[model samples]
Target: MHDIDPGWAWSPVEESQQPWTRQLAAHLYRRAGFSATSETLDEAANKSAAEVVAELVDGRTESEEYLAQMKQLGRTVVATGNVENLPAWWMYRFLTTTDMLREKMTLFWHGHFATSGDKVTDPQLMVDQNELLRRNSLGNFGTLVAEISRNPAMLIYLDSVTNRKAHPNENFAREVMELFALGEGRYTEDDIRELSRCFTGWEIRNGRYRFNRYQHDSGRKSILGQEGPFDGDEGVAIVLDQPALPDFIIGKLYQFFIADEPAPPAELLAPLTIEFRENGLNIAPVLKRILSSQLFYSPHSVARKVRSPVEFSVGFLRALEGSTDQYALTSGLSELGQVPFFPPNVKGWDGGRTWINSSTLLARSNLIQSILKNKNTRFSNGTLSDLFDKHRLNSSQEIIDWLETMLLAVSLPETVRLQLQSKIDSGSGNREERLKEVVHLICGLPEYQLS
Candidate 1:
């Protein structure tokens, strides 16, 4: 039903029309990373769409000082034995980092290959695994999946640590096919059993991957119609060779970057699947094609993805050039059903409409309210008047227009816009305080939940 037009162009549009430039920049940032500030959007507005996409895709590395800071934080978290604090530290990084796409992709892979610190309590192990994801965030997908197979946190989380020769654990093997590589029904029950045997010797020791040869089945196994004396590495290699792998990953990328409902049909994804597979499973090329494609700019793709809690949180903070208490932010996010390193289950957050039932919607509003109220919170743009004066916005209508454009992907109705302007004009507080209330209200809007 959701067929892509074959006539769609994959080349980048040099410059969007004047008004659409900022809007498109915001959309790009929301999908590529978190949202960008007005100033950042202005900078991007001067560039071509291809330029922006390239800048996001080829992100710069973190500086040595930044690396030192992250290392110190890691050491402190390990010393305290409070692995939970990892999310708080990460929230701080998300708020302040310039390597937006790298961090954003790290978050994506975290959900894609969901492993929780809750199960594998070693803070160092979790930290190591996170580094692994970040390093390979946009690298070769086959290499990444192979590395993940041996990651210490993954081994423990998927119960592969106890997968011995006699009694093989199927959790890791089953998930590798069903969730990680190929989707359901692509492999049979016997495949899971045989794959488990292939990975039987994988274990963790001293927070690192250790292969125990004696415990390994080391037997000839059949998986994805391949028969071999396969071990964990060979098992992963066979899994990656499946015809279903590219399509499965591309479908996931669509759900993440494009619309969620009316799923992108297999027909719509065939081209991307071909490019991804033919290019040796390197993610950057596929992402470039998708982001630059005519399809990416369509109405069906824009403003269609429901914002996950992390997306919402990161975007809000980035828009205001704001900072909040990390602990409070992490706590609020957990209540909103996403806590970075602690995905709800092995399957991760079922993102899309699932992000906003009644309870979560209310919790999201309450969290924004708390952030606005917090004394520690800081917005680089000062107050509403400062922003208005800086931008020369004298009227409530103009102010509302700018705020709504920056904050919401979808436009508010005429009546609703006027109502918001009225609130801004007559609200009983200083300009900053009133603006905070305005922002709080706008953020709580149902439309704000979308990218």
Candidate 2:
């Protein structure tokens, strides 16, 4: 189950110790974000998977750099100041970004944690929260939740600060139980009431956490059939103890990192939950265990899940030394339903089939056309042909190779290849237009959707 299957028709596994190892690492890194430099990919790929994964799973504290980012980000007490080039620059970061796995994992947490800039109403606060998500993305799941639970940004976004004693607001608590923590059906209305009380005094003041001693309800209440006047942290502690917590979280993590359909056996996940809870919510060890599991590398895992627009866009641009016009890139992503920094709701954009539709397909094709024409919005007669031949890809086979790598994690079948070649060889189609057509076809295909 080592994720090795020679019959699958992927390019042969270059020997790990060979110079191509870096090339392989670059490939994986590119899938996560920007393309890798030879040196960068070599550094990542040279390490054994264990070593590389360890680096990815852990996090570093760059307080000095963080303070700089914070200072540069600039904050107004009003929380709605406009940012300049930094917004576009961040998009660039994701495209040319390093720390490949961290970026990917942080994106996963963004969906899991699920907050939006719209409700938060403060770009800087949202940015801070985003950085926090990235910083702890792979390190610890429980810690991530705990910090997010009290996050001033989250409080404002979900109206948690509005929660009070005379009437406990269940908005934040319910989501914490239903959406974030135990999934759904694991906790009930009564549990929600008690949880809300525990968070009653957990308020945000002038953009900082200010627990109100007066508003706090110290009175006992039952949660998940357990009785207590459990405060906020204690409430989280209690919820984490549930038998299903790990299964819920582990299942989610599995979907993000491995096959979307992969499920953790109750036995495997139970122990993982216990280990996570016992380890102060540190997620690194838990993920190390998960990734190291024999089941993780099962044949079903590789290239199984569909890449999101962010993944597809970033990965393609990295591999092809590609960049797109700023607004169009944003527009293309918007049309695809995965705009960065603008998640749809607190739940974020749902993945998988939701990413595709007739509208989205047109948007993707247009983006391809734009890339081909050096930013032309409309296709001219034979304009695509001129562009392809201009690139000097005289041989139809070269076009096929470019499309294959640019569009797939692996090669396509010979039959598919021949069909594309035939399309290219057709006399009527312009070479550049045909090239664009080929890329468009591949991008539109089902296989191209998968990683």
Candidate 3:
């Protein structure tokens, strides 16, 4: 409930407690939310790992507000039958929202339980699903999965209504195990078939979920070694109780928050698993444990993952003033791969290496330049230096420092810095023109794109 204090920044630190800690925190902050500004970096670095985590949860304020907003947004959206230009909507949200965390986590859930607007074709369903994810995103994995399974958007996307006792569709059931809950190979084909039968009556009608009691078999079936005439909820319960389910869920958190590699040995996973099971699957405790863990900051984990395009674009937005028009910026993000709710497929975009291909990289470079020039979204102060100037940035050195601090918080090569200064000096322009070239260059480079 605390309003953001403009004065909040990291305390001045004399040195690193662990050199690797700085890198790990930066990586996690960017991945979990947006990119670092000089301001956010000050807030994130040199704190107890637990303190660093406070920032991730900082974005939670808008969930309650967003719930109300979504109701209005949804009603207006449905009556008009608006097929949202996904990028433009997201662009506006990214700039205007106090619920950046909600929006950001909603993004995570969209990918984790992948769906398609192409299939659902209802923006209300999409908007509704976004709320489900925001509410439960860092709350409960088990409940989140159950809610997602029942969601109208997902039901339509995965063909749940087609599921029947006589000839059940396995699409939703199979994915619940392979993709959503149990990951791969944990549940058998029979389990999926039986699970689909339990869910036979569950259907989306006029944007509501209905259970057709006459259609549901309510028959006993064996799933994960548990035998029952399990209905949808019971099927979900059986799947949740799987031994691999905790590891699967925790492993996903590891990949999302820690690293792309496998999770730590059983020693590290067991406590979080127990916390998940005991805490009614509230997710913050598990995430808190991971962020505070020594393993998270180990050298092997630092800089091991790449920023998803959304993160990259959001980071760019955060690096500037909150009022910056991101429509132009996100237009570039759309071209690169990520376009908020509009992912490339049912499986979503493969982040990490998939985000760094030849065409995508060029898009990244050009996007930085485009955004700096206000070519994508018109900027009140389109030039980067004016953004700097609005904050009263003076001197080429100060401008360079601001870019390094805000846009590229990580260390830049001195050679690159010198070359940038040379390029700026040779250009016959004011401070805006001079600093724009340097800020643009930093974002356009491979190093900026990498993390």
Candidate 4:
């Protein structure tokens, strides 16, 4: 990363140098969303890399019918009056949604804002907040911060549901500075105190955000060198104005979309930080720039991220065009550490290498095994064998190559490949069972844990 030129790194790749192939298309799909199916990858490879990314960034929007169906499904889940069921609802969306980048960004913001369902027990509130994140996922960062500050679920989770003028709650204020906008060390304790005062009287009343003006602290406050009798929105705007905000947010985005380790230096991120601030904090442009950049398609980013549980499982099923019981899939994800709308804590999951360990590795394997064994699991609306046959993958090597192309960010070791072939050749079951078992084994490999 240090040796890479910032200009060349960000410049769009020329076709003469990096031809838009199925493998590169797979990389884009894996990073931008869940992994794509072979068919999807083929479709993407037909166009220029810039065209595919542009379409992903600007063209994909869920149809009205799709939105209605998802809404109905969400209503049905919330009707159960159990917040526990919300994860399954979202898992369904992850598996089925056509607008992949938007959903992916929504997941990014969910971790960024880091609200949790454990405390905010109302399923409807959780669903509403999820929708809020999705709605503004690819829009202005400032607007997201303002709206989320007043979100009922966020207020409830942060213990700011009943902030009063006399004793203002500092949870949301501290988080807004330390986690959401400026990152740690960018704001002082005094700043948090002053900012908390701005949010006084902001409370949740009858499942809605309410400002009790009588309880509000209308006193002048000094925050981040700015002085004013600030309200919650104004306080948020001040925080957003801080110079550290763009670097903090863009750094996180770099980690989420690029490599997680060897954090990019400030100089390397200077271009994006400037653009993010100059563009009024609009998210789509930054995303478009990153996705289409030479750096994103290079070795530094490809296979650079450790697969989060959601990515590991969802990407596998998506790559295979497989479907399974949403409830069970949600359970598997919880075991693997991430459950949508139920992040472990305010910091959310520390992704990358944190997603891998002996325990999690085993859990990942178990989850894949469970999904394969589940009666409801189906690939291309039939058996895995049927899907493989559709793709003309008859031999073990052909199937392995296909799976590698669709599912792995890196090539499998020749030793592992040989072992898998041996297993498939010697396994004591039918062809479909052998193929499924080999895929499960491949997924357990360290190579498959990336991207």
Candidate 5:
């Protein structure tokens, strides 16, 4: 296998005449956004890999109307005081929004930061944090870390608001080092204690950040070999300055976007980490490198991750070019063990193979079927058969191939492909029923579980 080039930043790979094949476009979409639509695949097939990466990174934007709608929905949720509905609302945006990459990164950061509404219990605060993450999702990492440190949802969730001069709560401090910035074993107990002291008096007042002067510990402290009378924000900055920070973040990004089971070795990530740090922790550049790198298109990285429930549910709907009740999708995702605002715990959902179990797998299948069965699900601006008519895909074989391209990340075995083709050919109903049957079978397969 070809190793990822260290100079992948500016070096464009040689482009073939057919550079943007359906397979490459599908891989790009699955990793960078959700799965590709037929329209997106068609458009991308005409562009080079570099152009596709650039556009996926910078071309998309959320519309003002969508922003207004999201604000209204959030206001409604906040007024109702049911923070639980935030996930359902987010699913609505995910289903309809044009800016897929932003939403995708927001989801990634949600998992990376791993704060839950279960702890905060304020709908508005959770909504605020979600927006903060989205705004800075592709922005600078340093600013994001500093802002998240003071985010009301985070302060409450990690007990940082309770951290004070006399009695310091180390939960937030420990997590900042352990989970957010640096991985475990990179910091000491002394670091956690000192960082907690630095964060003293950082409290939430009427749903906003308030630093209580009386509760603050003003004494000098030493953390990570630096001594100062540092505040919470400064502490975050100091931690971000650590040399180990880049490797920790890059590895996690690799796990999320590339392979997960057999973690990428440190040697493979060293060059990328340098680029990440040199670029001032702006995620877009590193992402551009990864998405455009030779290693990304290699067999070792493709189809290497299991789709999170959100990915499976949202990507499935997007692929069908269909729409459904967001409430149903939300409930179905919950059954699959991932609610948007409500991650199971601080560590968030354990993805990968843990996404699939006996019961959850059943729930996944039922959810896809329910979406397909929805009366409002239109393909090609009409019914499912309209999809066939619009695409000129009439035969059973062409329909199967199209569905496979849209749905499966991994290749199906020849025997399994033959069996599915047989099933489609043997169907008694018309093209719609045959298409649905073939698609349903494909979704239920193990291959579809992987991204």
Candidate 6:
């Protein structure tokens, strides 16, 4: 990666270098959003990579009808007052929503500004926070930081619901610097103390954020070489103004959209960091540049990320045009580790290799098996066999090739491909069951675990 030129890496790929193809389209869709269906991939392959990425980044807004449906579903879940149901609600959106990049970015922000339903308890507040993340997912970073600072779910989760002046809670302050904006070691302990004082009157009352001036500490404080009686907003501005903020955020984004291992060198990230900083932290442009870049379509990023549990399951369902009981799906996701609103901790899921272990790997295979076995699971509103027939996948080779193209990020070994063919030819049960078994087997492989 260090050997790659920063300018050429971020530049658009030429047709001579990498012609737009279904495989490249699949790579873009997998990294940009959840995976796309083969039909979608075909449509995307007809266009230039720039055109496809422009569509993804520009088409951030969901249609009014889709928004209404999502809003109604969210309301229904909140009405039940059960946070457990929220994951299913989001899973439904993940499967059905057309505005893929927005949803994907919302998921990214959910991990970045990690807040859990485990502590917040209020279903409405949690739903509101989810919406908050979605609304600002592709917008201004400074604005997102400002809005999330006063978000009730975040306040409650961070134990800053009542940050009194007498004993200011340092939780939000420390996290705002360490996790949210600047990376760790970018700010000092004294900075956290002073920043916490700035947020002293912030509280959550009646499920909304409120500031009680009486509890605020009005004393002058110094933070990050700036002196002022900074309120929470100003304190956030100061933190966002730090020199390290761009590198920190761009580094994280690189890991998310590019690769998970072999942390990007400072030189490689310099171009993106400058773009992000110059654009006033507008996320869409940076994303647009990254998605259309030469490096994004190259070997470095194609299969670099390990699919998180959400990506693993959601990508499969989306790619196959499959649907199933979302509640059961959410349960399976929980068993596999990522539970939407219920993140494991403030640090979120450690993603990458951490997603796979002996137990979770087994759970992942079992989850796929359970989905395949469930009568409710359907592909294109019918059985898997019917869907495959619709696509005219008659021969074992055609079916295996199609599965390999749509599902796996990396190419299967020749031996593995032959093994899959053998299963399709001789596995137990009817053809549908045999095909399903082959899919299950493929998903269980180490290759399928990658994004």
- The TM-score between candidate 2 and the true structure equals 0.78
Report the lDDT tens digits of candidate 5 across residue range 132-156: 9999998999999989998999998
Instruction: Put down candidate 3 lDDT per residue, 117-146, tens digits, no spaces.
Output: 666677777777876887787777888988
Please list all clashing residue pairs in model 4, or write none if there are none.
none
User: In candidate 3, how many Å is residue 341 off?
Assistant: 2.3
| Order of models, best lDDT first | 6, 4, 1, 5, 3, 2
Over the stretch 174-292, how does candidate 4's per-residue lDDT look in tens digits?
99999999988988899999999999999887999999999899999999999989998999999999899999999999999989889999988889999999999999999999999
lDDT of 2 at 324: 59
Computed on alpha carbons, the lDDT of every model, listed in order, comes to: 0.86, 0.66, 0.67, 0.91, 0.84, 0.92
lDDT, candidate 2, residue 414? 90
lDDT of 6 by residue, 324-429 (tens): 9999999998878899999999988788888989999999999999999998999999988898898999888898899998998889999999988988888577
Clashing pairs in 2: 140-283, 384-432, 384-433, 385-432, 385-433
Candidate 2 local lDDT, 1-451, one digit each (tens): 2333323212223322233344344445543344443345547656764565566556442356655654564443224464332244356556544466677777778887787755676666767787789778777666788889988888887888888888788888888888787988888888887889999888977777888978888899799878877888888878877867776876677666656554535554455666677876677777766554433433455466777887766665655445555556666676778876667887877786677688877776666556666653322223444434544657789867755654565578899889889888897755556766776677667667776
**Candidate number with the higher lDDT (3 or 5):** 5
Residue 374 in model 5: shift from native, Å?
3.1
The true-structure Cα RMSD of candidate 2 reads 6.0
Taking all chains together, each candidate's TM-score versus the true structure is 0.96, 0.78, 0.85, 0.98, 0.95, 0.98
Q: What are the clashing pairs of model 6? A: none
Clashes of each: 0, 5, 9, 0, 0, 0
Query: Candidate 1's residue-wise lDDT over 28-63, tens digit each?
Result: 888888888888999998987788888888868579
Which residue ranges in model 4 land beyond 4 Å of their true spot? none
Better candidate number, 1 or 3, judged by lDDT: 1
Q: Which ten residues in a row have the lowest lDDT in candidate 1?
A: 9-18
- Misplaced by over 4 Å in model 6 are none
